[model samples]
Target: MSRRLVPLALTLALGLAPVVAVTTGATAGQAERRAAPSRTVDLPDGWQPEGVTTGRRGKVYSGSLADGSILRLNPRTNRTVVLPDSAVGKPSVGLDYDKRRRILWVAGGPEGEIRAVRLGTGEVLRTYTLPAAANDRFVNDLVVTSGAVYATDSANQELGVVELPAGLTLPPSGAATLLPLTGELVYQDGFNANGIVESNRGNWLVLVQSNTGRLFRVNAATGRTLQIDLDGRRVRNGDGLEAKGDLLYVVRNANNRIDVYDLKRNVRSGDRVKVIRTPDFDTPTTATVVRRSLWVANARFGVDDPETASYWLTRVDR
Candidate 1:
């Protein structure tokens, strides 16, 4: 079996603070202020939370490594319950829910399997094995829309879109092959696009290079791509990305921080720049903005110790 090799393609940015002030539309001004930071809830013993998503009812579903389980964190009751245990048999990297079907989809992890589990009865309704020429390929992070699920392939250096049909099987066709990242433009060691999120503008997909910290915008209709960051330099080890309205939140892995960029604030060459930096994080790997608050998954594994990995979930006020 093939395994991924590590390379020093990351940089650390430290001692920075939020510097940009955002002015929004008149209607947005009337909206309430973003929520304040909340107390971090440590997971139960052996429950290593990796990814988080909010359910239709505002409940938080945290993906855990302990038993490959999803846990519903009920803050009001101060209780956690293992949910959608069908995920227990699979290695789940990222978790997101489809409100229309009430199905929870988890990106493939070590096993390269994407699963759709019914939240109502905790049954795995379907599974899709990633098709790859490389044996070590796996799905990293994913974003689900009304029609399809777009997942990033770290090992194979590709992007895959899995369509959701009734009964949910891997589509017989319609998988997309993204434009290859090569030459001096490619970030990381051969296009390791680890994190993926939809553009705040709601039309494009933002793919982050884990090793190089470069961001690329992928066209939804055509697989054609453009580098969002023109410099081809590291912004921090870009791990996971989350877009809440016009703001894009990115997890800076090497720096152990979360950085926010305003999509509307373009400074040079029509590219958005990082404006806020929140440090004091431990290998912060992925972020999700829910309930007007930002949640981070601290993987706790960095350049210092890439072999051993552990994680916890934390929240920050916007």
Candidate 2:
């Protein structure tokens, strides 16, 4: 073992898998914390890309709100590849991928629809519709757990919990059952629950309300929730949430920034750690963590010409 401390230059190449430029004898997860330079990729416009997710080997996926198409993008190559027969359910706002089972879960907007699509063949494995009030639903973000997936319903203030059988794959017969939210997480007039994620151990689920920018900790089983106090401050316009262990990233759309926090004591109260921002942010709707970097999808909802070929995804170094 060497006892000398030397500055190490790590490079995580963009592509299906990261090709390191320097050797530091660090695991991929550890290298992610220190490696990986940030860059932004231009997305073909008019797709209205919103949902962003990462599969193994740093393969990124985004859904089109305008055409219901799912695009697989290689960040390392800056190319978009189409998945065969994969387009289904327009406005796929939020997405999650199950690497073990090769499943991609999609959440639809307004209609409150959910779809389980097989990754390789682009087959629709199952479809579940979440119950919500008429004309007032935004089936928002979702988090995949070891045994289940918890999704947030913005309009109705509920969570649709879909339990995965032992294989981490859902049968066509499986459905999304409602976990009615109560207590402090009552119905706020608009966009109540937007982004969602589970704790590192998959023990509890974290939810963010878009309108109030409030955070809630929920028991994964019983639907019990409590407000997470944040030092007497509010995260207004909070959209998407990503949690890794005790660390959390809150995406504030239109604010063009993501706030990082330390979630201590089961995320009861979070201490703000850092603020990530970029001039490339154009109403970033959601973000996904790949290794130690954050890939943000620009929704461009504020732009008058969302159809213009000017949308893009920005990479942020963490």
Candidate 3:
């Protein structure tokens, strides 16, 4: 793969701020005394993990593609614990943490189901099945907002939304609504909407097309989309997304790198400010930001003997 450096003048013209280092309150002497956390953490063999998210008290979570099992890892201590009562035959694609309810919303790939699992205990509170026709349905990724949880169906140009009531309780089964995607985005042969996130203070949703590497900004209420301009650059093989304020991280699985973009206030456009590449990455599919560091999961797609292959998470400093 070729690496092109964007000119500083052009980046500024595109409304992107230059990357700067964040300062800690500790002095240089004290900072040197404290040891940094490990950059890599191992997962169980044949885990085949994809989605990743962070919870309270520095807890990191990921789900297995092989068996749909959920695992919690403590990066500081390098400890891991698999949550019990997970669906064995299904696959867990994407995950989001609900702070208010202390639940983890899991995106069931191919099964077209959404599960709300209680934290620590892994007790499945509810399983909401999404409506699908004769065509295949893939619940690729999801994002949880204040009002609802929106999931992307990669095989179709629509989103599965599960509305949360005022009490923030889970609804009954088979209650997920399919919101058809309109406007600029068109479904292609392969995966369409892979990863999703909310931007511009929950007014707009950002989705990434895996095959085309294009980004779209969708209206939260209407589901109308508009293509985001990236100055003629494309994030080919984009798999997962992580957003912090105005900055967006696009994980390019095939490229083994993460593209960092500075999204504008309207969420319709952005500029790539940085590219993160590390030796620890091996087809990373998704990531979550924890304590100013990115914890990325290696899916290791197309590997021989996947049932016995090794998997791990790489920590990249932001």
Candidate 4:
């Protein structure tokens, strides 16, 4: 299949899926609505954009897997600015903003380290060595809040939390703890525990287990876990997660769909899911919300396209 056609097909597939029941624990008014495309940005050739973030400057920033490069795309102009030496060979996934420090934090793949870069200059500011794990331990999704950084250790199928000091520097302090991975979500082929979104309410963190298509809620401060199934079936490779105020947005890669969970409404809270169509793509790895829209990183597997993997940092306005 051609790379250009994947996302379009997926978007159509999403439009056809049945709607799941929404629950009360979901974000407010998010479940009742479907997202329509607001705008689109085509990535540069030979670039697979992953780990995207929207800067306060009104540009989208994403990491490139091919060369460990970082790109800043200005949506208004459709022009891209490549950051020199931004790409790292190891997968760079999960981007979290430290507004207090004016920097962004990234998790490297499989026992790799955590890196921080200044938003203003794009300079590498700090690098923290990740604790070793028995499995590959790909540090996938991450979120920063209350001076603590919580990242998903996917290969190990757990979540790791590292505390960041107020000043922001390399080698963040505190110990790493493993968060449990369990839920009613089904296990599917081709993916594992992926994206995570920290709930704005209390110390709760919601995790999307890509392999099993499950959603888990964990207490960030205590590491306690609660498993909730999205209806009864497994969610598609739930790769991307972003929470804005009362709503949480989830991206299912295989389904090529996005689901919005309204935290406020009682009927659609924690258990229900409604599909929102996304642009055409083979695999969507991650998503971040910037301004009012969502940015998605669509990466095709190597087997799908041996010569090169066509990826996009697509912007969804809905």
Candidate 5:
């Protein structure tokens, strides 16, 4: 998270020294070699990306902390565009797209709001404001579900959930409800909840606590939660989370690494399979799987010159 919450959007200002790398799963024996699965793409230095997601045909999108905008990055063509919005300065911390409905749901920080926009057209259809609470609200990350949408409030202990009506897209008047996280999810210091994802089974919700680096499984229907065991190792500095099949990716920003996990079918626990590191990472925040690669948004929260600091996304092949 940022000074906006404590700071704004993301506060991963660890500013670790740069560690660049170059790796390809190749050897010089054969004339023909396997395609390399890792690379890096540079963004405008000040984009200050905290979230990343993918749409059809490997299209990648990142939300901005600098201007609260969304940039569509085309890896194949090396192009980027800021989506059209009536208000250009609203912060979008985390977002997910509903491909079936062509809806992009975004988390609005501090203001405690969620916006639903038409993906291709960049038209904001509805904005749902969650219930006001006494505690400060930092609407951090979110996942769009089959029947509803779930958003994590890092400044608070509960989840802001917006239930969708029978329609495929967000209803014009949908209201957001706060799902108080109970059971094993006892709130502690530092930004609590950050990245979130729906399990492959779609029966449970998976979340990462940024401060404690603990994973928790929540029953979608009940507010019940269970701490996901990770062999007693914490995923410290966890920011955004993304899951594909049995694979779960946890972006640990300050550590400048994405911790990969092989998940059990139940989604209650997982094993850290590998740690993906790229030289391009400058406190990378979140990532999305596109085809055979994972695209990460580098927030670069530590750079002194956010106005001039160059930002980029690391592409790691599967």
Candidate 6:
């Protein structure tokens, strides 16, 4: 589901802290040498961004929920550019950059559409309309793999799959398929499958259940799932997921924090290694690691007004 529509009263009911310190043991000098200089990059007012991904040459990409426009940010130079209108007009929730094909796969929230945009020219190459009943689908996030692209439907119990042809060629429209989720994972009242990532060397896909605060390991081919044990810790309100080697980062939206987990070799279990919190986070929805730092997109849900409110990206040193 698009979190922008979640009521403000529900957010207040969570009683999340406004700030939580990120603890580290390294000396100040050592930390400064290892970490990049922390900073913020302001987005267009009312951008209402939810997703973030890093591209070649240190370029950071995010999509605006308000207009479906894609914004490109160069953190090093602090420059910004808005992509063409070919992919605009639909809410863009999550996106991934395809290095092999130089395409940016964007999830069309509530529209049940996935668009492939050329990274260099901003031309929308193709828009695939996922098969689902009207008003019953919310294409939340997507992850690209070697042979296919998998997307989550926050409002349903199935995943939208787009199989790429040989040579990583984009498939024709109406070629997408649906993979029904089975096993321990269940769809609840609110958002169910929100974020997805491939782990265990691409043998397993890890998914976060937003409403239940549970992580599940899914068989990519069979769609069978098993709940991941998180050492009794729950990542409630988890929105976007990022996996780096054996480490997984879960962005807990309402809590204003990101939880890092150390996953086991089989990806069936994990231990919470750290909690990343900052005052700058205003309902951060997703993140991408760049040069030892995490660039987070603040969705700022529940603000008094979204159309005129300020929006920005917070760069936290990991």
- Per TM-score, the best of the predicted structures is 6
Please give the TM-score that candidate 6 achieves against the real structure: 0.89
Candidate 3: worst 10 consecutive residues by lDDT?
14-23
Model 2, 176-226: lDDT tens digits are 788878768876665678888887644678888877778988888888888
Q: How does each model score on TM-score?
A: 0.74, 0.84, 0.87, 0.78, 0.87, 0.89
lDDT of each: 0.60, 0.74, 0.83, 0.64, 0.78, 0.83
| Model 5 root mean square deviation, Cα atoms | 5.8
Candidate 1 per-residue lDDT over residues 270-314, each given as its tens digit: 334543333335556677666766667655442344333433566
| Model 5 weakest 10-residue run by lDDT | 1-10
Which 10-residue window of candidate 4 scores lowest in summed lDDT? 11-20
Q: Which regions in candidate 1 have their CA more than 4 angstroms from the true location?
A: 1-38, 75-78, 165-191, 200-202, 230-233, 265-280, 302-311
RMSDs, each prediction?
8.5, 11.4, 9.0, 6.6, 5.8, 4.8
The stretch of ten residues in a row with the least summed lDDT in candidate 1 is 1-10
lDDT of 3 by residue, 1-318 (tens): 112232446434422223232336977666444433437788888888999999878799999999898999998898999987764678989999988888999999899888888888677788877886556888989998888999999888889998998796778767588888999999886778999998955588999998888999998799999999999999877889999989999998766778999998888789999878666777778989988899999886756566887789889887
Residue 209 accuracy (lDDT) in model 5: 87
- Please provide, for model 5 over 1-318, each residue's C-alpha lDDT reduced to its tens digit, 9 standing for 90 to 100: 222111322343332223333245645433123333466777766777887899867799888777777878888987887777623577778979887787678888777888887677566788888887768788989998877889999877788888876777456645588888999988786688889999987689899988888999988888689998888878877889999998889998777788889888777778989877655666778999988888988887755668776677779885
Which regions in candidate 5 have their CA more than 4 angstroms from the true location?
Answer: 1-37, 173-175
Candidate 3 residue pairs that clash = none
**Candidate 4 stretches greater than 4 Å from native:** 1-35, 167-191, 264-273, 303-309
Candidate 2 Cα misplacement greater than 4 A, ranges:
1-38, 132-135, 173-175
- TM-score of structure candidate 4: 0.78
